[model samples]
Target: MSDSGLPDGFADLDPFVADWALPTRAQRYEARLSKPYDDLVSFYDAVAPRAEEAIAYLNGLDINDLPDDAEKLLQLLYSMILVSYAVNVFKQNRIPDSGAAFFDMVAEPAV
Candidate 1:
């Protein structure tokens, strides 16, 4: 019901939609690198707790026919997954000691 189109109870995540609801793996990866460590942590903190609830909500829907709002939510979840590594493991935006490293995703699954 929010302007971001995310389902109810997820409006708290509205502030992140423009940045985190990226539509592609490559974009999401780049987003992870572009954000500061603190920003990444903030995103993780907000989404981590709701991840399970989001999954369960999505599970009942038909993947082939998700609504626009649902799709955005899914994208946010994907971004969360990408951010988790930075927040939970790397503890930085980019991989430690791997300066300027990048992954060229030649192919990605159809959305």
Candidate 2:
């Protein structure tokens, strides 16, 4: 693992696009997984901050005019949103009505 807590290939990723490199929690928990469990946890911790930055950037883009590359990233951000829901709402018992939100917020077209 590198100083960022992520393994080598992951530490240098563009923070906004790092989601493509992160393994979902489900993957880490898979029965047949080969990687060390500790490595998975470390990677998750390292990627969490980058994922937040990515989500924020994606939230500011207009969905209709998004670039092709960004479209994939947008989908990845949505997956992160689902993970947020699981952690905050389900595991932490947070009320959806109180703080629920989505990352994608398309800007209004100029008049």
Best-fitting candidate, scored by TM-score: 1
In the range 18-110, model 2's lDDT, one tens digit per residue, is 333333434312311343434334434444666766566656778668654445454444444534443444543233455654233245223
Segments in model 2 whose C-alpha atoms lie over 4 Å from true places: 1-11, 14-34, 64-68, 71-111
TM-score of each: 0.93, 0.35
Whole-model Cα lDDT of every candidate shown, in order: 0.91, 0.43
lDDT of 1 by residue, 43-92 (tens): 99999999999999999899999998999999999999989999999988
Alpha-carbon shift of residue 44 in model 1 (angstroms): 0.5
Candidate 1 residue-wise lDDT at 43: 93
**Residue pair clashes in candidate 2:** none
lDDT of 2 at 7: 27
Off by over 4 Å in 1: none
